[model samples]
Target chain A: MTMKYKDNPQAVADLVRPAEVHRDLYIDDEVFALEMKHLFASTWVYVGHESQVPNAGDYFATDVAAQPILLARHTDGEVYVLHNRCPHKGTKIVIDRTGNTGKFFRCPYHAWSFRTNGKLLAIPLKKGYKDTGFEQSEAGQSGLPPVGAVKNYRGFIFVRMNQEGISFEEFFGGSLSSLDNMVDRSPVGKLEVAGPPLRYMHNCNWKMLVDNQTDTCHPMVAHESSAGTAVEIWESIEKDENTKTPMAMEVIAPFMSPYEFFEDMGIRTWPNGHGHTGVHHSIHSDYSAIPGYLEMMVEAYGEERAKAILGENRHNTVYFPNIMIKGPIQQLRVFIPLAANKTLVESYIFRLVDAPDMLLERTAMYNRLINAPTSIVGHDDLEMYERAQEGLHSQELEWVNVQRLYDADEDLDEEAVENGTTERQMRNQFHAWKKFVVASMEAEARDLTDA
Target chain B: MTLPTRDDLIDFVYHEARVIDEGRFDEWLELWGSDSYYWMPLDYQQDNPKNMTSLMYEDAFLRKLRVERLNGLRTFSQKPKSRCSHVLNRPSIEAFDPKAGQFITRTAVHYVETRLDDQFLLAATVHHHFEMVEDELKIKLKRVDLLNCDAAFGNIQLFI
Candidate 1:
């Protein structure tokens, strides 16, 4: 039996427009549910990196679409993304966020056990339900249900919960290169998760964070206190003759780059609400080189290939519904939607295998300074998000605007490219948000009609 | 010349909290010795800050930069200005080394930071590593570990 996907998709469709979107899209309960079902659960979301669960039996448990899910490396050495559930009873099998399950996952409740690949091993009493539905059902023996598909492109494992929407290849398409670029930067051509991520709670809808990725306009204004302050202090230090300004200042100054700088940087949006910034140059492009980072790259890939790998720096890549990656910086931030009004942003940096220790340190510095819960820059953005969440509740404003460079981007293809200041990315995102969310409902309706 | 006793060491812990709570940031700066660090770990039993990500890992440079940003007039987020209050369980003097001039104190505290109807209380265990810099007690390291360190937290605008 299938769920009667709650009717009236036009309500979802009406919320998004070419240049503006309804305030309800950011604050409404109904829209959030539609998103959780049609967009998040249906599509391929980046669950975790393969390096996180490298050895056999290592598992990383997390919530996907508000359901308990874990990525485990089976004894067979193939990684499987499975529902972190016990089929016998509904209790969660693994409690630890991440650990090795050893030989198999043992249930704390019923003494039932499962293989790492989600195959039911044995129950306590084998003859208890000999004649029941248990003998006829595949589900009884199939321990934990895996997600619809798992695509591990260069160690970035993406899982789609159900095969209701677009195929993984069609869903990702050209956007896969962003993940490729991140892995290619590694001297050994591999990346590993540094450690547990820094999770910051936002009291706002998740889309606000998604929209913020290509929102090149806000950093100069919102981070005036943070990155702007760095500039002032560095200038003060510069006035003294003997002092050379610190590397810390250089890390933050580009965020406060002028409008023209961002305009020159540019943005490119793909078909399925995926896109990237730093077309000409990213905020990361100006940083002082780490001592041995480029040397390691050159040794690995020679001059031209290493130059291309090091030279091309993308600021942020939005993989639709949830995650964003900064390829050059070797960092990823996932916006896990907790509720209509709450989101938990888990930010993690990757260690390029065999790269300079300073590169990881530099990435850590950026993570703490920009993305951490205590981040001086992130505080300003969080403040705005909270205010927007609060203000959207008012009866006054019905719609939110994303009209910057709207007209300019009209004459573009399936892959739309525009200036950094353009709201084309937001337009591209909301357009997909409507298509994914509405198409699911329409498909359900068509099913009912065909039946 | 008076030798610093346990009472004086306890006073230093309470004084540090008051300085931060009262928002006397410049005065707070005077309380730190050179090469001091303020660390809030991301996970329980987090061993080192250099290798792993932290809730915050700040040196003098970052600390000053944070203060400057908080004090900046153009920082729209701090327009209302965040304020904090420390409800401390009396400090326990863990160790006293007078010869090498080092003192260690631990305190369990409920730190509340609030601004414009948003008030969040943080349950924390604070470990302060102190060293006497020219006879004046100064903090060498302040490590704050939250009970909910593994849990998601809202943006912390003020220093703990």
Candidate 2:
């Protein structure tokens, strides 16, 4: 199958601009397919944390732009990201999302075997192929195609399907501090996955989830009903001397914050569509200190540095297309694109190693209350995303406006630090989106012409 | 042992369901002891609430918050209001503690909830650990093992 649009980079590039993006970017089938090939397949997508697959033979399976991939810890203590397909007949070796494949991966279809690092070990009935010319091919030698590049930064693993882009550190730019702050929270500078993730699917484009990460404008409007209920209930309790404010109300009441609060909170946009808001402090600041944890931190890093580390409270850090990390709350949401209109979100909670149990408990509580599939606050966000996808199907709405703060800070450098309520982050993402798509399209066109 | 008769236990379970089905949240609150726990584990055989995940875990304070939100007119998901019916199997007493006036009863329940023409059926094994204080049986712990606890769920605005 041939697509003429692949040759015309300008057609894809014109879909995105500094101030607005065409609805086709989210709704069109061709655009989604291009994004999967160019944007997702060509960039450094987060696979899993090294802590998730701690021991030898432990494997975590996931998709990189619809390409089934697995991250397995080999016996040599190195984690390798490999294609999940058995090279012999293209059968998926790892069916489960995550498990220990033991010493090596044994394909259920045939008796083909491979090492934990995806090196082909043996094929069934070697005598039959002995006389044949099938001595050693790429399929017989290498069981599966290992990911192009696998890098583990402070236990966070990122894999690139194609080795066309820059290094992960170069890709992360200034946004690396967000991850630094997350791991540096612990005195030992290590973190662990709390447990199995809370997995759910939404009927919306994957970009919608990414856009919502730095969007400070939606909470007040989208969650008006639920937040208002919490406020009303809280006031009634305050009026009565018998009752007290419920701790759970803290989760919902923050959604009722006036626009001015978010406006002043500030947003920071880095290179490569990486951006975050609520960088100064958040509602987590209001909670009482985790008992004795501060002393442990101060002892390790001294008072000034410990204070700085603990005070860096970021709401959500968008790592381009697939990952968002909430440093203070100790949670990460990974978006997996299933199609143009469907995305599967897997949310993982992290625990700071050697930290007080109270801290982990608080984070776990926040995950349940805020990110759980049955969460009231999360339901409001899901409703808006689904509605946006459904509403954009109309031909009347061609352009989705991302014009806030466009005139205020047209300068690229100055735009990095803007008001939190500004849609600068969204615009910045589309800027990277255009760059990635156009580059990939041009590369494919070059290959075709050369052929 | 001062255990409630099988007939008494059946009546108690039915009346509890009636309170929830009829949207009598205030009356439902009265059915629990002051130091009671309402929890639904996120994973099968999930024992520790503090260490692991739970679909729902509420002490009296959080439970009160949920009730207040459901009754508040501004609760949008509950705007059209949720109607539910609970089909409970015959109660089986698991244990009886004479000294502490406590009894553990187990039952299988099929809970159907409808709101704004959208309906969901949740099947679960319920364990009600109650104590007989004087003649009143108050729930000390209501643990629900949902058949699909780990599955993706929409807004669960009201009590399960």
Candidate 3:
């Protein structure tokens, strides 16, 4: 049986055709609201990492689907996710972004308290509600409403508001390799976020930022000026004396790779909207020159396993809807959607535990030179996102094209591989988006009828 | 046991800021010691740079690379060049150890920068630690603690 939407399903269907998406899908307030409801509310969203709150009473405040949510570790060492609103009078629990809430959470508004797991602890005036219909059961005061499902896989926590959907394992699928490869770099399979994340706001739709992650066509053009500067610097130094390309130039020059080199690197996608392309070792393959790191890896996990771990060089893996993992460089960039035209990007660098100090130093260098606000390379990407957003506002342009090789066989799961320059990743994302929206609207319509 | 006076330290800081503001990259480069470090830490009370990250942590080599880009004609972001005006509060000498030959000073700085019709303000408490090589004080470590260092920012291409 085919489910039907109460509202204009034709409009939603037409929003994402086979080869193009309507411009309004990005800037329309109605579409944004529907996405927040159907796509965000129903899917699994990434919360804070478990290492962020390792000790009991440690809490990290973040949002899932624009809804303020709290992630905390209790005395039992189990992590839990809860809505940020207080049960009484509906005030926020933790005012600051993150900190260790000693013992339990004490609300600033009415002095109501809750445990680290959001269990109602004590209220200041207990006798006032003796017979006022405020029952004294475990859920009487209604401490806080927790998300329907919370799963922590290898210390990376993901939460889903709706209970029914694909399991976390199934939703992540082959994309889990991205996370596994990152964690497995550590001999003990653990990695810690090195420092505080570098946060910045981009004036564009969130999807545009995500699309650019695997959109190989734009880098050569968008980064032309900065890449030219790097090349000029390298050439000037070489002209003066005998020297190799500067490490900084090596980092920026790859963004200028010819279309042929980029396309030769395969673009592959999995079930759901996950996709990744480009080589793993990238510019940092030279990092193999560092001493004792390979020996240490060989000692920990034998030569075969170590070689496999070091040899798997995949770049820019998108876990769909929000996160992008550059596993080779040990950096995770998360996109948080603020509005139809605004997004927040947080860059988190990781440290491979028990690894050499040079690895962490290189990771830090990459973040400063690439992800920082002062980044010469990053400004190019930012300019492109903003310009694309502004250009979409023109009344003449109705559709944003994703038709590059749209008819290719890359859409099939068994043969889901294409040249890096193809738009199959973007098209796959829309297919997933359409599926999510259609299911969401039908469920909403059924609820309206039931109500 | 002689030490540099407060006026001398203030003048040094003022001159440093002036050169950076004027885009006199060569003159600015001369103000640092051969083994100097310029750092802007990521965390408020960061412990060690080896384990943690920093926003701007540059050695002499990286610093020279940055200056090369800033001074280059091909730096697209710097083509129009950001102009800055720094308002520094009074400097106070914190410590003067004769044996160590290091003088420490601290000051508050409010910097206003403009580029292509966009302007932004950055405030930081600046710390300078140095020792006299002969008669001139060369900076060994210059640490800047931005008031909103952890917050979001636009491109920080120019010196602050």
The most accurate candidate by TM-score is 1
Q: Scored by CA lDDT, what does every candidate get? A: 0.86, 0.81, 0.78
B1-160, model 2: which lDDT tens digit per residue? Answer: 3467656766787889889988899899888886898888887778877665677777876677667667665555555677888899987888776666668889899999886657889999998888776677788898999898767666565665
- Candidate 3 local lDDT, B43-154, one digit each (tens): 7867566566677777665676677766656555665788898999987788767577768889899999888878999999888988776667788888888899788776
Segments in model 3 whose C-alpha atoms lie over 4 Å from true places = A1-7, A136-141, A225-227, A238-250, A279-281, A408-415, B1-8, B64-81, B95-101, B131-138
Write the residue-wise lDDT of candidate 3 on A1-451 in tens digits.
3323336556787789888999877887677777777787777778868888979999988777888899999999999899998877778899777899989999998888899889889988789878877886544656877887999988788988887876788877877887888888887788887878888778788899888888887767766666655665566663545554545555667777788866877778877788887543343344444578878888989999998988877778888778888777788888888888888888888888898878777777778777777676677677677778889999987999998877844453432777877888888778777877778787777878899
lDDT of 1 by residue, A1-451 (tens): 3322358888678888889999988887767777888778777888999999999999999888878899999999999999988887688999988999998999999888898998888888889888887866765866888898898888988988876567889997888888889999999999999978999999999999999998999888998888888887777763657665566777789988999999999898888889989887989898878788888899999999999988888999999878999998799999999889999899999998998877787888888888888898888899899999999898977999999887844732388667888889888888888888888878878989999
Q: What is the Cα-based lDDT of residue A258 in candidate 1? A: 94
Error of 1 at B118 (Å): 3.4
User: Tens digits of per-residue lDDT for model 2 on A281-368?
Assistant: 5555566676799999999999999999999888889998789998886788999898999888888888899999877777777777
Off by over 4 Å in 2: A1-7, A135-138, A238-247, A408-415, B1-3, B71-85, B112-121, B154-157
DockQ-sorted candidate list, best first: 1, 2, 3
TM-score of each: 0.95, 0.93, 0.91
DockQ of model 3, rounded to 2 decimals: 0.43
Candidate 1 off by > 4 Å: A1-5, A137-141, A238-242, A408-413, B1-3
CA error at residue A181 for candidate 3, angstroms: 0.4
